[model samples]
Target: MVNDDPRVSPEARTRVKDAIDALGYRPNIAARSLLLGRTRTIGLLTVGSTAYGPASLTLATERAVSNTGYGFRLANTVDVDIDSVENGLSLLLDQGVDAVIVNEPTSTFRHRRHGLAIPVLSLSEPLDLSDVELVVGSDEAGGVKEAVEHLLGLGHATVHHIAGPQEWPSSKRRREAWKAALEAAGRDVPDSIEGDWSAASGYEAGLEFAKRPEVTAVFAANDHMAIGLMRSLQRAGRRVPEDISIVGFDDVPEAAFLSRALTTVHQDLAVAAVRGVELLMEVLDGGREGGTIERVPTRLVVRETTQAPVASS
Candidate 1:
């Protein structure tokens, strides 16, 4: 009756429930796991900076896990190196999680093997490793392509890019997509300024861009950087959409509330996170296999920040 075993008679079960409610009894998780041979818990190993995207994904995943009636454990590592990833994984494994979700977005963990007994899901790029059971990633390329095409369609001569750190797979995918969109449209592909996914870096890039009259349009990797870039451009006496236009990725909650109402890419991290949990459940239930990669689509939300370039005198 305590474990809710169906063998108990209705009268006994009712008595047990009434007594339990009276005493406010709680089940012992460790003891239950010992008896059932499962913890019913999901572990998440997140490796990277606490950027808006990653941080939101973590929270979304936690919510998804809880909604599915599973316990959630999280171990975070600031560094993207292999050692940090391994340490984080070890910490989660030590807690006896039934499955693990790896959110390492760096190149180092993309194909690495983690010889774990339980199922593994990766929320970063798709991995071909034998140990990883499933992969769920946002459509980094699609959103970037849309943003670039929108800029070009607005009559910008060429769209300059402020790319995120090269180490992250998401950054690489966005940068590649930006370049591919320009090439496909027969537009000149300018050199990209690499940012560390930081507003400071974006502001720095904007300072340089402000001096270049040829830079009529810009695509920032994320909204935070876009905000910073817009600030710098405004400080330099360049009016957005009049002298220069900007588009950003990751349509954050604050994007719409900005002074210019940023035009950006909207990728729902919660959708991806929920799908990841569902896939992991399938794997645990022996219904899904490893090497399954899922990409959630993104869309462009055009707002006030982007427009056709003004004719130069």
Candidate 2:
């Protein structure tokens, strides 16, 4: 009856249902899983509590999970070190999750699942983990490549970069792509400024840029840093797109309305999250092999922050 066997008498099913309805009984999902050997639940581990990418991806995963008729649990962490990740997953597993999703693992993240018995998926930068079933994220390298190319097409002499922490896979990919784009075009590869994906760090880099009049174009790894860089430039009396052109990744909500609208790379965070969960489902279905990475696409978003460099009279 629990299996809903078609051979079971329909009247018998109705009687059991009526009895349960009369008693107002509800099946305990966890207990039911114990009996059936499948929980149909997924655990999610998000990177930062307030970071834009992780936050948006979290919502996407939740929506996707709901669509799949599965329950979920979430854990948020600021630290992405291997030990911290292990602890986070341990907590989720204690909740009896049948599967797990690591929302945004840093590049420096080391994989050690402590002999995890269930399938593992990640919505972070694609790190080919031998033990993981699926890894997925936006094509950060492609996005940055496009962003840099766009700025170069605008007649800028060179496009500088403000990158996220070096430890992060996304930041590293973007940084490498930016460098590769510059080299491919025979443009000088300038040293990149490092940021913590925070406006404060970008502002710090901006403070330095304000002193260098040679900087005409810049690409920031994320939108928050872009906002910081722009605001800093404004304070230094440098006008965006007029005195300095800028491009950022991750088209955050307010990017369009910023004082001088932001030009950015639009990463479909929600789509990536949905894809990760879908991949997880495929893995759980037992036909797909592990180590597959699905790359979600990203596009360039032109806005007021980018333009052709002003010609010197």
**What are the TM-scores, per candidate, against the unseen true structure?**
0.89, 0.87
| Model 2 agreement with the true structure over 135-177: per-residue lDDT tens digits | 8888888888899899999999889999888877778888999
lDDT (0-100) at residue 33 of candidate 2?
A: 73
Compared with the true structure, model 1 gives a TM-score of: 0.89
lDDT of 2: 0.84
lDDT of 1 at 121: 82
Weakest 10 consecutive residues of candidate 2 by summed lDDT: 106-115
Q: Which whole-number lDDT from 0 to 100 does residue 224 have in model 2? A: 96
Top candidate, metric TM-score:
1
Q: Which residue window of length 10 is worst by lDDT in model 1?
A: 106-115
Poorly placed runs, candidate 2 (over 4 Å) = 1-28, 107-115, 126-132
Report the C-alpha lDDT of model 1 over 68-184, residue by residue, as the tens digit: 877999999888877787788788889898998877775464235655678788888755434747888798888999999999999998899999998788888899999999999
